[model samples]
Target chain A: MRIVLIFALLFAPPLNTKLGAQQKPAPLEEVKVVATTVLLGQLVQTIGGDAVDVDVLVKAGHDPHRVLPKASMLLRLKNADALIMMGLDYEHAFLPALLEKSRNKNLQDGGNGYENVGKRIAALEVPKSLDRSQGADLHPRGNPHYDLDPENVRIMAMAVREMLQKVDPGRSAQYQLRWTEWDQAAKQEIAIWKAYLKPIAGRNLIAYHNSWPYFAAAFQFKIAGFVEPKPGLRPSPRHLAELEKTMQQADVKVLLMESWVARSEASGLVKRSGCKAIIAPLLGASKQNRSYLTSMQALIEMVGVAHGLPTIQEFKRDAKEEQ
Target chain B: MMAPALLAQQDGMSQGAERRFDPAWNPAIGVALDAFGMMVGGGDGNNEANDSITLRSMELSLSSRIDPLAWAYTSIEFGRHEGAYEVELAEAAIWADQLPHSFSLRTGRYLADFGKWNTVHMHDRPHPFAQGVRQEFIGGSLAMDGVELHHWLGIGDLPVRWSVGVGANFAGHGHSLLAAESDEDLSLGHAHGANFATTSAGDFGLPGFAWTGRVSAQHDVGDNGYFQWGASAFLTAAGLSQEHDAGATTELFELGQNTLAIDLTWHRLAATDSSSDTIGTEFFWNQRDAVDETFDRVERLQAVGLWGFYLHEFNAHIGAGVEGAWWEHADKDDGGHWLSGAEAGRQVAIFAAWKPTEVQRLRLILAMNQPDPAAAADSILAVQWSATIGSHSHSLDW
Candidate 1:
């Protein structure tokens, strides 16, 4: 009898109690939280400390805008006590469908548990109007890319901390403490990155999309133009011709093409303009990249290379003359 | 991850059922409501009054995962058609799961895989509606009834999916309410057949059924993204002649003819978690071989187009971008009934969309569309306020 029991225990299934004991239950004190991006997910994980379970929907290196919400995301939203999202239509295509199909009131807009993190952060590229016909596709309210800058991230962390504490009042102090630590870390990193980018400061660059306003502001990079004539619209021959003329007039060299955009088109523009186009990580490190810090480091290095600065050296170096 | 988890749970149930005879059917149902409106008044003349308002198009679908390898889905839709109540076949099809060697079969009246726009309808499509190019070229107003066989091949980093299909019976035949008759109106191209087609004056030989064959391929390129290309050939032998009792000598005449068309699109979604840039272009060439010289003649259509969009997150809350497009179609020779002309135009739009929650978006867009003389012929300045209630992936795909 004893032998049979031992065999059954060994081969039948993992005992729930044993599994529980080996893998400590994420402490009840920490509330589980979910985010749609790795950067935001990591940021939440840091500030919430042991009190939050941060889940990221889009893995690293993927475009959030194009993400097709999977059926599994419905379950995630349903089970989540509160839902946080980037406010702009960045996740427009898939997120609304996921929320409606999930039927999770907690994640829906206007619900007590729902929050738009962008509302708490500063925005860029505010157009005078929402009209898209004139120049290129423009964001009317402003640029939706506030998270690319570290300072804006601080604002988001505070919002997350406030919301978590509001939902789980008992853990208010813990949330506050973690928020302090995260803010300090973020500020420190921002200062470091700024100092690192000081040499390449004030350089004019062209971006394929209007994604780097905050990053550009922090690093002092001026935007010469974008490759796309408008948002969601492909570049037309006439548009490209006009842009090439503008590039020639502007003397822009570095093309800040995101890893998500097709490189062939950008490379073609580069070939035509004699500019160096480099693929920069649009979203910081993902599961593949391990952590947000590493992703940021990678981004800095990529930007440095584009600027013709020393490659990955611990010490900062001045930008080289235009190659 | 969810599929596996569900499968494991099912295994437990199956084990429990092994001791008893169990008969069962699992069913799934979904309902959706869409609001739509059309502004028709401001055209050439006030003759066409502007009738616009938010109206509903409701649909319901029933589905069953018949077994581990088979499934079926059907839906019924009710809505207004040209200002009248209508009920139509929204969807009806049975799909075979992964058969031996990654093969599958589907039959019944379903969408014919044409361009990226044909696969998904207006409500389910990523954008607010089909682009003008799709509406004009692929006839977004069209659907097919038939069978489809598809297969997927895994080749290293790229997964290629292909499909072959045949369909029949097209709806909606409208002609220029403004244009008059000419020799160009005779045996027309399939695209224009819905609008007008010539008939034999005297009783003679009649045409047979129209048949179409399609081929499509999609290739995923590592982390960069994926691209898809497809083409279709439709044929209706010379016997494809119809008769009209409009004071003519013959009851029917032989109208032997052939029509052919092709299209392609590429989608490179943003990397794992960021908003990626997407660019897509399509070229369509259509031909209608001349039937009996006695039969009136119509010309072919050649169209080429390109559309691109860019999205970047300012932060989790705010992001903005733009999209622009251009399309041009070549004219054909209609045998003396009328004149054929080519039309080319462009559109540009800039938009800002706000997502207060993951599932809700309040977007304001400004757009300008130029028209072709053969088409609408009037430029449009459009300001749109669109709020989406459900999740529809915005990735560029059919």
Candidate 2:
């Protein structure tokens, strides 16, 4: 009877171990993705969700134009399972160097894990000619700010969804599920943005640079002229005078500027035109705007406020009270 | 030893869409015109920068990718020779990437990745004058014909690079920037080592041509600051004279050389690339075997030099800076022959620059030069204009 008890105890250990293995499965390994910009990081995180870990190459609040792959950025890239980029040579003059220096062939152009979201969208404002003298900064590739158009973002989401599934097939269903939910959220937020900005519909806005064509097209706003005579050149006094004339004619009340652009150049225009200037950061400017949809909502809310309309926050509070 | 390949920094003048190099130029061609007019010694005592407004070092560079794995670059320079223009090959090398273990290989006649200053061409210096320490110890620049292996230590967060090089014709120094005709400095050539080559009877010379090793790295100091540091060592031997015998060649008088250089540079770049402030310092120590013309025998002489500078760019078009360079004989000043002329000297300068665009710059410099402590200081003014008309890529020495 004692030997029988000992045999049962020893065999019972193996029985419990087998039951533990069968009952509690291990979690799938998360794919590591290195995304170039804060906006792209937000997009990757949305689609990857819990199945992937996203490392942002260009940290938030830093100058987006100043993306230098220092050691830290490079190391993260080297270890990444996939890399997401905003193509169209969007100051990606450093991309070739980064890939070569990282010595990670998997992230190169032809590699399996390389993803360029630019390919997913049809670009706007593609120059007919590559004329260097025509303007201050004419991108040879069409406007890369297509993501500003929420529709283009949906396209980018599809591409990201496919990329994550390809890199981490075991979590394909999880990524697809997150993508589906993200699509719904984006659609709802975009509708709110359109309604919030409806008061200023068809109003021509003055922008410091050529960053807002996609955004203007997506919303109901009209863009008359820029503070800069050309796309990237400083606004000459003559150009500013001309732009002011256009602003008066178009009744443009908002002057939208990028955060990296110097404000001193546009300060005179602000006073002369008496238009409210809105400085839109690249992305992830405020704590509340931590994600892509939130960042876009924040930008839309600012424009609404500038036009003397209620912000999205007020709109949400009113809806809650109604309910 | 390794020039940090600075990522494409949007030159504020370039606006947002400007590509630093014109990729449209199929085989990327670059040209630079460097001309400066300075004191020509208009003051109290002898100092450097005696050239009287000369257009020197017009470099024409050509580069193309050799294949998927390699690229070749060649630079030819045209300068005044015997009161006429002559052309010389500055650098011609092929760099191969895609090697195993983050290794890159470069082979040809190129600047030996020696000190930070030695690797930078004269056209790229902020000021027109070469720093005194590096200029006196190793001449304006040290070019080598051989192979260099570079390894990017993908260690942790910082990008650390180590490079080792060995080759012949680790020729003497830069000729255009040199003061005058001197044996220590030789003309650039594939067989330049032959200038100092002799028979094997003088086994004093090392069989290997020249050897160099360097380790360099950089890190971000703050939100808008970058710091780069480098340490380098170089060794080479050359024969001073060869005795001719009746039938065979005789023993040679060989001078063994060793050089060590350390440098640190910190840059406070504006949020955009519109403006920046730079503060930098470089230290050099050189020990060499040379024929002491006084005693007519080989003597080991050591020298040390230090240079520091602070430069601030007010905006895109304007900048001002102050630089001071000092060097002296570390060994007893017994008046050696080969290097005695440049013994102990110091130069200080304050200047302002007008960079109208990315490709055009004009600078006005006011400098005080004292070759020796006992000598009178020479005050001089310089006006320099530099222009680049094509795509130029400099693996930068930031």
Candidate 3:
């Protein structure tokens, strides 16, 4: 009786172990991807979902154009399976150095694991001929600030989805499902944004830099002129005097500038021109602008409030009450 | 209703259309020009032909990806020589994509991967003048016609990169192998006698081949700080040969030479503004072996140099820095006659630069040098203006 009991106990343990192993599903390893900017990182996260682990090189509130790649960032890139960048020379200042030092062949230009979201968008402000004499801050391919427009964000999301499917063929179905869900959400939000921003349409505005041409084009806002004399060139006294005349003639009442740009120049212009200045940071640059949807909503609300139109929040509340 | 119609129009225009790939495939071309005016005075109160304004250098550079596997770059420099414009090929190299097992190759005439300062061009250097050690040992821009193999070792989580190279005409005129006249040598003419006159393969009395290697490591110290350190070595069987018996008989003496250098750099970005601080230092030890004419025995001559600097960026458009350097030669029974008069010396320099934009810069430099043990110290004040046109890509400094 004792020998039979011992044999039963030993057999039972092995049987239980095999049963547990067979019942559990194998876990999928997430693909690692590195993005050059915060907005691109957020888009990659939204589209990639659980299929990818994303790392952003340029942190929030920092200028993407002036980011200096660190050694730790390169280390993260070394283990990444893919790299996504906002091409068109937007990251031209620092991305090239990081890519060369990473020594990761898969993430370099022409590599199979590389994707440029800017290439997917229809560019704006493209020059007929590019020369340094025109300006120091010229982007040869065109304005790379397309992400400021929600429509362009949708296009970028599609590019990210395609890249993920190509990199992880086995998980294409899961990526497609998530991409569809995100597309639906983005479309709904974009409709709301267009309605909320309608009040500010056809308004004359002034920008501190050449960073908002795509946004202006999308919203039907007529940009009077930039505060700077030219792209990346600081304004001289004479140029500033001429800009003041143009601003007054256009009846511009609001100045838009990024958070990183010095407010002194914008404030001075505001004082002289009797216009209000609004800090319109890029997406993911602040806690209020965390996600893609929230960032777009915030930008619309800021512009609407600046022009004395109803905020998106007020509109949504009113609509809900009417419904 | 109007908003929806407007958005619909935007949507119609935003359709994804494939851009012509061939039209976008263009090489990046850049031109950089530097000009400076200077006034120099000696403490001994003898100053003539020391005040002048001249164009320092003009560099034309072009780079492009040749294919999926390689990229090519070339830079040509034009400078004034004897009141005439002279052109020289500064750098022309092709680098390959890293292959299996993390290895890559670069070939052609290129600046050797030595210390941190040797790879940077004159216009880009923080200081207006080259380091005393760099001028005395490696010369300005230690370029060599060679093939370099670089490998990145994935050992632990630390970042370590290394390279090994071998080249021809390592001791030639254009390539400053063991010792050759540099652009600084031509410009200053104070350290001309300190360098060995073996400027070609025939002068070395041996096959003019040299080998160089470097190992560099980088570490991140805190959120916005970084540290980097590296060591480099160069060796060649080429050295200076002299005639015996006062030009009566020439001896076929084979000579050997080598150089060793170590460098350290620390950089920190300001937490509140666009300011940053960088501290860097490099030390060089150069040695040469030759048969002494009088002793009839092999003798080794050595020179040691140390240079250090601290640079600060006040803003996007303004920067300032200070640098100090010291060099010494081993005194032998021959009273160190092999070294130039000003080779063993020390100097201190301070500079400030104002850049209105990314492409234009104006800088002011104040320098004081104490050359030759017997000569009095001298001071120089220089104003430099620089401009660049076209695309510019920053290289991997590590």
Candidate 4:
């Protein structure tokens, strides 16, 4: 009997193994994925777990506004079963040509295969009037930069899950299961970030572009002003001088600039204002050996470090010192 | 201006000459009849009526797409003052291949690429609209018979696009000529003099030739939904002229003139779920070179204009929004005593449009334009109904 048991163990389980090895209800079909950036790639993967193949055209740390299509990039767009775009004219310069070349006319306007992530989230910088000349330049249809807000990311993820369900009805239940876990984790992380930010919520900061409105609104941070008076128009010496004077009055301690803008200008402002400058990633950044989550955590950690407050490192040091 | 053609022909067609048919070919038949009535209000000196309405602009055209690459675009227009019909856009040409950068070349009687707004000729318009100072200062804003080579390039991974064109006109520009001391305004406020007559036709009287070149660049960003920012510059010059009219006195002055214009436009298109926006700001300046053998100084006209619009579209079916235009010309003060009557205006317009479908659009626009209240006083309430029967890319008129 002992010899028989050893033989059975060497081969497989007696009953459960035989049933389990027979077949999967069916081999799970590969899930179709369409993403605008690498951050979405990570998020979808974390939730999708494995049964999917995701393709993102835009890399992290790249300016979505200026992303043009290469010949190779066109081939990738053509093969995608679905397409996800930031929408709200953020990628206007490139998306039109890409769609035309892909011969994907269905994705042009109201195609079912096309998904606009901005539609699911609220926008900032919405102008009161439709006039383009009302103070340099302003977005008449709210701000399209909702991606900066962590809460909005959750909303976007939910929309993505819904779209994925439509794309793969067979794995709808599995996708929901994974979505719940990922969304709950995201909500918990957001709460932790909110609490972490509570100490310096009212701090004043200056921005390079108008990209920070959504983030400022979420955290109750006051935006002192912008480096460029108008979008796309370079700030004249006179304008920069005026901005310096305003910065002194506002007592802005931090100069927040987008990574895409030339650092020399922000450096000039930092030198003139005698303030700490932070080159923050305006979009989902893909740093070497780091994901979007880690990049965002690094940014928040830097903010705490810039304030000269108790960083997580500092806290750990203090605890050891107390010990 | 004809020198480029001769040069190109001499350059040897065997170099890279490929025989290809134009993609923009259309053989369609159309019939249109238009009648307009305008009211004149408050004229003091030599006015016929205090308030009267009359036919303003009416026209009919027979457009023919002769071949794959060539077209025969002909139109006849009737004016209110002259009360006579004349051929307006009687020309033919071909649109060549578009480059990968979205730039294309054309050899035809098309309008000279000048102002952002003037590229669309009046005869092509479904209704009559007033041209701005930049358009008015530049001759007819119409095409000179010539061949133009154009291209677009980006600025080092930025969202900026540069459009450049080099070409020559079949006829010289006439509006740049200055009036002589003997010139007088006729009863119709029309300057009947050597300047107007010679400039309208040119010294050869066959309309002299002119050399033209222009460079325009626009950088757009997500300034707003259905709105973006853009700026462009254009330059045109009447090159050396050989033919001179001995009988006409104004033709005796051979001064090559060049005009330059720069402007910004903010444009936006929105739908319920999606939106597109572009904002552009422009500055324009024109200079008249004194090719005159006489003691005339080079004159210049400088004007600044800001034009932009924001549109909130529920969908392609329905949308509403507002647009604004503000223009001011540089002050001109010479020894001459009569007021130049240079125009400046600020206009704010609210408009609503209904698109029954993708191809048909009905728009209602109401604008209050204050055009040089001191010099000329007139406010217009214009409504337009625009529609298309076919694809946009296939039509040259848009």
Candidate 5:
């Protein structure tokens, strides 16, 4: 009996020492936060600064829509003080199972430590009615790709700051200061990006999926149509023909697509419609695109150049020449 | 700024209100339907009856948080059995989630965590049919009315989980799991008693309760692969007892059955594409003991089953797998002579599945089974269609 008791105690889960023994107050520990996507992780890291440790579940270049949390990911979540996610069913495919298995009450939905950045932000392209025939990729709450827009990124950063402050009250001031700096810098960057996109502000564009609606809305570009007939369904030949007619009628000259999507159909569409197809990274697809600022800047430069607008660098150089 | 307003209208939310739970909060409700068409050859007396299309099972599942400290899950299955529509309560359990020392407790009827496959639901199984030893020994599954306690821990960053449970259920001849038979009718084959044993405090009887325990450890094999190994054991009284006398010596004997199993699984998904692969194997050893009419004589019946399968996903929509299983049963009589029979068998099956969406699946399976002492083997071809609506399939910690 003594051996059995000793064996169980040795193999028990790591308990919270402070909670177990209510004697002296334990020192504040670093807040460990787990984010569902690379973009969200970047936002959390930027705003939390040195006050928190951030772990990302879905790595760069992977589609957040199809991720299955691995055992390692679950381990990261088990010790998390808070969970930050782009919730409008964006991570629904994997998050529920992971949370259920993690058995971490702090990170479960409705818990004090759960932070859904997209919950408070307004959503785009929400379906009016539930329809599975729309190709099973429909987001009932709204489009969860809002992180593609710089403005939404700012909102998400603020949400992360709020979550950090709640989880680690002792570092609230530190988090607030860092968040203010990031917010001002992000606003300035958005202004600059808007200036770079001025020449093609109202230009009509085509994209391979509905991934760009929030982005187009933020940049003041008009989306003429999508290559896919619906959200996740592939474009049939007839649908492509109809899209081509729409593009020709609107005189659309740029077709935007993500790097992960197959280029065959987008290339065919560009050839038939006489448009330039610009493939852009949706998230941090590479190390160079790891930061939210760098990824957003790349997206703006790609779209601006594809639409025949001068690149930001060229525009600045030309302005200097004029001065 | 204008984008937020546009999206607010797009999502039909008020200017300041966010998506939050209201007073009428309810859990997600889901239903799954499974139907199959089978063609079989060389099954002794049931060949004609088995070669037909059947609606195998329709399951309704409900899951919700009962309170801040508890969660509940219930699944009810309705299907056609013996040309009659039958309804069975598959699982109805409530779990206490917030316990000290990373422990949790669950109570009510649930599939006992006996082996790798017993805890899984039928619709999610790789093969359409249960393995032979599972059907003969445990009656396919052991869903007992019981309580289970689970604990989770990590050893130097490697996750390990274990559980212990006890339950009271009818266990004996002709008492198949999930079948329509009543508990009172499940007797110990006239050797014990006319009525099955009960676990109620007032009627507490010997050999009435079942006990089970399991332990598992998991580790990451590589950047993209995970390996898990588990061991489980189950014990129960078969309720079969007898009294024997030899001259001036008298003895009372009872039947007891025990099973031990070990399983290993490796799963990996390609980092670049949707392709994934899983390989798993399980070995089981079961023994049943009974004393003979001769006061001092004892008999032992033992069975060993080994099963393995490999599943691979070629892409997002298609998957294929092959599974094989073998079972050997040995019985030793009072004379100490070992006897083996047709109960020992081997089966091999190959199947391919097409999943058009995450909630729908279609599968084609071909299987061959050879039973010991049988003149010829049996072959089967079957196609299965399964779909779920309203919620994701209920999954346990894999």
Candidate 6:
């Protein structure tokens, strides 16, 4: 009798009904999208509006490369209508395991609702060889921080709108209209930022990681050096000494650092190089600046003001008056 | 910059055929090499090799995504048992995630998802020693040749996962280290072949599968800290214990066993990479029908064990820890009441490790062991070198 009961439990409805998988997923009232980051989620929110419910997988101040797959993350992915991700191995460490374990099929690669936003945008620092003789190389495909560039943001936003249309086509017109408006406003903001950032456009700045290349390319600034000798590796003392010498010899007087990166990580370099450090958000990190557009504006103004330049708000006001 | 995007997108599409067959998309090959050297001072002659070197324990593992619906993992282990070495298919499992209600089904031959310790491989253990109670009760670790279903749910910020497994190993058979050894006459986790005088009765075999259940919960104390607690239960036929008078069997009894365990772990990561402190504790209580052949008594034997460890990683390259274990022999028969000189014994070890990289580790351990409570403690010094090359993956162990 006990053996019979054990076999009965093994083949219970919840465990066996979907052995091969549900032929058709139950209809969702709203497209439940799981975005890999807050920045991507904000894009889905802006373009998707009320037609979609977006769940951010990686939380604020968390590193995507070091994500520890947890149960809460799995629960969210189990029923997701779609998945938005920054490809190029941004979610490499954790996404594969979680996605395979998740019940949601739409989020899988090649699925209609699966979107890799980074692929549509430009990539930088594509490695010529996959060599580990130097140190830990987290970014093997290319730099995944293309969202740092506003033009790339446009490409990613376009992707979010298209993915939503594919998953929840009833709201296609609503998404397309919002994306058009978003692109226009983003253009205006980028114009204002460029005008104010023109002074430092050709100047060189030291960065903490390889995260700022897209931002540098967009704004026409040159990255003089980095605190970390290699990507994902801590800055050694000897490397810091060499970086300081480069900063002094090259007359690079500004250092750009991301918030959430321990300032202590770059403190030694900051002291030796005598460069003014400007800490900026890594997009949609705070509740107040969760929107990509607002975070970009805040990031530009913080860097400009720190370098003794006037705020871009004045140029934004001027542009509004001209419009 | 815009040119790179356009050129890369075009190049990417052209390389689509090549990408499909890329080695990166296929199963990852991983190999682990483990070697240990031990020097013992004194013991009750329990271990055959008091001063010896073992280089046989090695593992090769493969893992990759099968498709959008599943992921798979398998491991081949080469290990030692009683001065002899053999290769064992330690684990082979396919995880199907596209089930209903957030339930994941894992089917294959794999570690029993019971408490924490059973799933840990010998190479992954904190110290190089036989687990006391677990060795006596289950084996080195428990392996199940069957299916396990797992479900994850959350209560606010706390996350919990539960797993239930049914397998033949649960039915007192298989080569899982914790399954002890393939079968009754073959291997026991730490075989006490001398205790049971009667051979297993051919007609006494039970046909039911073994059952295993586990519930684990996790709480994030802070950004850098994690806490986990869990409980597990295992029910199975524990083989036979018979009463024999002057080498003639008088009564035969089937040993049915019920085992319960609880575990706790706390890990705190320092800001620096690979620098952290972790403490874990596990306790087990097991009950089984047994015949104290010495006393000619048939009764339910109750046994217990406690094991704990504290590991501190000083940097990316170095770590140290202390592990201590205490267990009461399953036969019970304590001093004065039953047939016993002593019922409980303890082992403690202090170890230090150097990890050149994530895949490489070399460690040295100094241990004081009381194989028998009535015997004086023995001290042993050991050194181990373990390394994993190629693809390596594991849970965060939070």
Q: Best candidate, lDDT-wise?
A: 3
lDDT (tens digit, per residue) of candidate 5 on B57-124 = 78888988888788999988887644566777878999997787668899998887777777777777
What DockQ does each listed candidate score? 0.09, 0.23, 0.25, 0.02, 0.16, 0.12
> What ordering of candidates by lDDT runs from best to worst?
3, 5, 6, 2, 1, 4
lDDT of 6 by residue, B226-247 (tens): 6889999977674444545646
- What's the CA RMSD for each of the models? 16.9, 11.1, 10.6, 20.3, 11.6, 11.6
True contacts kept of each: 0.19, 0.32, 0.32, 0.00, 0.08, 0.13
Over 4 Å off, model 1: A1-323, B1-26, B36-42, B131-138, B171-224, B232-273, B289-331, B334-376, B379-398
Question: TM-scores for chain B, in order?
Answer: 0.65, 0.78, 0.82, 0.58, 0.78, 0.80
Candidate 1 lDDT, tens digit per residue, B113-202?
554455564455334423544434333333555677766544443334567665555332111111110112111112223311332122
lDDT (tens digit, per residue) of candidate 4 on B170-277: 332211110111121111111111221134233333224554555544333232221212343333343323233444454444334444555555443321122334
Q: Which ten residues in a row have the lowest lDDT in candidate 3 chain B?
A: B172-181
lDDT of 4 by residue, A1-323 (tens): 99998888889656776776754444246765667776677667766668778877665556564443443344455556567766666765566656654544435457655778877766776666664233323445677778778888787777777766666666777878988987888787677667667788888888887888877887778998888776644466788888899889987878776655556667887898888887664334344325555566566666666766676556557656978
Q: What is the TM-score of chain B in candidate 1?
A: 0.65
Candidate 3 global TM-score: 0.83
Give one digit per residue, the lDDT tens place, for model 6 in A1-323: 99999999888777556764734444347888999987888889899887788888776656565455665566677668899999988888788778766656677788878999877866898878776555564577788888888888889889998998888766777888999999899887787778889877787888987789999999998898988787656677888889898888878877887654557768777786677887766556467476777778888887777677766767667767989
Instruction: Give per-residue lDDT, candidate 1, residue A199.
Output: 87
Error of 3 at B178 (Å): 21
List runs of model 5 lying over 4 Å from the truth. A1-29, A71-74, A100-105, A108-112, A203-209, A224-285, B1-27, B42-49, B170-206, B221-225, B237-254, B290-298, B330-343, B371-373, B393-396
TM-score of each candidate? Answer: 0.46, 0.81, 0.83, 0.44, 0.80, 0.76
lDDT of 1 at A59: 64
Give TM-scores of chain A for all candidates: 0.78, 0.84, 0.86, 0.81, 0.86, 0.86
Backbone clashes in model 3, listed as residue pairs: B193-B340, B194-B340
Interface RMSD of 5: 2.7
